[model samples]
Target: MNCPKCRAGKLQGITLKTKQGAALGLDQCSICGGVWFDRGELEGYLSGAVEVLDSPSLHPKLAVELDHCEASCPRCAKPLAKSKAPQSPRIQGDACAACGGLWLDAGETGGIALAEKVNAAFDSWLAGLKPKA
Candidate 1:
């Protein structure tokens, strides 16, 4: 499937197991550092299906959300909302509050959800198990 954010490239196929042992889809970038998510997958990942387990030794890439920015959903061209990361509440992501979609910035794919530090550790290790680089 193509990225809903932009026609930049097609979404890669990736299924990563979270620390909680739930499998989440991983949509990596072709040129830029971003991860695309199907609306349903995003919510499920956040709702604790794929719980994160964080570790300080791991420097997972942080997701910088452009939700409040001008960037719109490539599919609907609707504005996205800034929602707190699943693992960490402090970190945020560009979520299409209208469409239930999410937009993660370049390199932010690996960052732990700021809501829970313990979950972040497991999330990071699980994030590293993707099919590609």
Candidate 2:
């Protein structure tokens, strides 16, 4: 499969195991380090159940600037919609509305992981907050 974000990169198949022992198949780009997750894969990964290997740390100076580039789903050949990662406006990626597939740019997988951690922490803090009359 070819990467949707970087057309030059060929996607390689990989199996990711969740904390629940569920094995999920995903495609990743070799050249750009991007990833493609089929329906529910991203959600499953973000559910805090998957034990993903530590992705390379993010460096502000090395960040890749993404443009409003048009892309299609490698699975279905349908147009992909651009969307932001929940709770992290700065992290944006493409999604296939038809197949529910997601395309995360290089370093975005880790960014999403970080965002999920931050969101979880905020939720926990909010839960501990006392309501005043």
Candidate 3:
């Protein structure tokens, strides 16, 4: 499948290894650093549980110029609608209504990861304040 953001970059299958030793198959754009996540895949990736093995850390470029052309779903050819990244309202991404696939532009995935960490830390801190049962 081709990248939804950068039409020129072909989507390549990348296997992400989780801390638990499980492998998750994901697609990434070699040129633009965007990632395509199918239904349910984004949750696992944003959980801080997934990591790439023997791969260079993803340094998403923040200055990439997005193609103004409407992004579409590579899987189903449906027009992708803009939506906020899960659990991260500040980060926006594209979602396919028909297929439930998501297209996150360069640097947005990193933002989501950071948001997840912040949310986790806040939850932990909040939990500590609860009255003893």
List TM-score per model, in order.
0.52, 0.73, 0.77
lDDT by residue (41-128, candidate 1, tens digit) is: 6655556545442212212322222222355664466876667756446555677766666777653444545444566688998989
lDDT of 2 at 9: 74
Instruction: Identify the candidate with maximal TM-score.
Output: 3
Model 3, position 6, has a per-residue lDDT of: 65
Evaluate model 3: give its lDDT.
0.75
Off by over 4 Å in 2: 53-67, 85-91, 127-133
TM-score pick, better of 1 and 3: 3
Model 2 root mean square deviation, Cα atoms: 3.8
Model 2: colliding residue pairs? none
Q: What C-alpha lDDT do the candidate models reach, one value each?
A: 0.56, 0.72, 0.75
lDDT of 2 by residue, 20-120 (tens): 88877778877667788787676676764465533334454433443346788999999988887553466678878888787887777776777678888
**Where does the lowest 10-residue lDDT sum fall in candidate 1?**
55-64
* C-alpha RMSD by candidate, in order: 11.1, 3.8, 3.6
Query: By the TM-score metric, which is better: model 2 or model 3?
Result: 3
Q: In model 3, how large is the Cα lDDT of residue 76?
A: 99
